[model samples]
Target: MPIITVTNHVGPTYALEPRAPTAASATLFRNFIQWNVVNAVDGYVVQHIQRNEKYWVQRHFPRHQTYQAVSVDDYWECWRVTVAAGVTTITPARDLINDKFTVVTVMDAPGADGTVGRFPDKTGTRGRWKLRGLVYFVADPGLVIADWPAGGAPSAGLLHSRLLPPIQGNGLARNRQGRLGGVLFRREFAGSWDWTTEDQRIAPRADDGVGAPPLVTYRDPVVSARNFPALAGFRSRNIRTADEAAGGWLPIARRPAHG
Candidate 1:
C-alpha cells in the first residue's frame, strides 16, 4: 500500500501588487500577479509529481479538493492529487457517476524540501496548510457469477462463470474485448482450492459479443461435495459497493466466498 501525501499552505492574503500607484494600475497589476500566482502553484504541483516519478507512476488518477474561498474576494484556493501509475480498470467508479477525470500531463519536480509545496506565490504564505489524502492502487472485482455442482455434489472437473465489471448504469457493463476482458482463478485438487497454482484465464467474450466466458476447469471425480476442491473465488475492489450492484451483483449468488 503506497501512500502519496501532498500538502498545501494557506497564508495571509495580500494584494499581489504592493506598490500600485493608482487604482487602475493596482487592478491591472493585481490581475497580472494573480495569473503568475496561479502559474506558480500549478507549476510547483507539476514539478513535485515529476520529481517523485520513481515512487508514483506517470499516469495519475486525479482527486481535487478546495480548501477556502471567500465570496466577492480573490480567495479561491484548492489542491489536487494525481496518481501517476496506470491503474487501468474495466470501468472506474467516477465514470459510472459521469465525473470528470484528468489524464496526467506532468511528470513534476519537488520544491526546495522534496515535498509538494503550498500555492500562491506570495509572502507570509508559508506554514498554514492542508494534507491531500493518499491514493492507493485499486484493482476491483465488481461481481462474479459462477456455476457450482448440484446439491450434495462437488463441482465436477469443468466449471463455468461470468465476471461483471463495475456497474455504472442500468445496462452499462465494462466488458472488454478478446484477451483483456476475462478472469482468472486458482484451482486446488486436494479437496480445497489451491491458490498457489492459480493461473487459469477465463475469457468472457464470444463471437456474438453477448455472452460470458465459458470457462472450464478440471477436478478429480472421486472428490465428494464435502471435500470438493472448488476453484478459488475472486476478490474485487468493487465488491460490496454500488459498483458491484451495477455489475449485476446478487446477494445469494455473487457474494464473496469466505476463506
Candidate 2:
C-alpha cells in the first residue's frame, strides 16, 4: 500500500490562521474555529462557516492528567482555503475524538473586502493564498501512550498517516456480546451558523466588524447512534451536564464541569 502522509486528519480545536477577505469568492471569509482541545474528547460539542478579514485563533493546552483513570493528551488539525478568494466554506465534524479525521474549516469576506479590491480578483495580488496548516505539538505522546496500533479499523481520532487497515469505513472492527463492538453512538457536526449583509457587500476595512456567532463549531466524525449500546451500556462516567437521566441525550451530557 502506498503510504501517503495522513491528509486532512484533524478535528476541530485546531484552527487555521486569520485570512484577508476577497471578491472573486464563494464562502466569503467570515469565521473560523478549533476543537478537540483535550483528551476524553467524548465530552465535547461541535462544526462551522465564513464571511470577512478575520484571524482564527485556536489553542490546546491541558493542565495535566485529571481524568483520574483515562488517557491524557490532546489532538488537533489546521485548514487552508482551496480557491484563494472563494466566498463560502463549510466543514463537517464526523465525531468527537479525532483519530486522523480530515477537518475542514471555512470562512468568508463581507462588504468591500470581498470585491474589486476585495478578493479572487484574478487580476489582483490578494486573490489566492496557499492557505497553510501546521500542527502545534501539545501532548507528550511518547510518555503517555504505551503503544497505539500500527493499522486496523479507524477509531474516532486514530490516523494511519499512510497505513490502511483491514477495516474500511467508520464502524467497530468486531462484534461483541449482543451488539456491535465498544464503539458507536457516533455524531458528526451537521450544525452551521450563517449570516448575510443587507447590502450583501464585503466590508472595506480590516476592522469592518460584522461577526456572526458560529453556526456549528467543531467538525468531527462520531460513533453511530444506531450502535451506541456498546460504548454506552458499559460502566462509564457520564458527562456531568449532558442532562441525561445519568444518560440518554446529547447536550444532556455534562462533564465533571463545575460552577
Best by the lDDT measure: 2
Instruction: Give the best candidate by TM-score.
Output: 2
- TM-score for each model: 0.13, 0.18
Tens-digit lDDT track of model 1 for 76-129 = 011122323533121112322211111111112122222322222111111111
Each model's C-alpha lDDT?
0.19, 0.21
TM-score of candidate 2 versus the correct structure, residues matched by position = 0.18
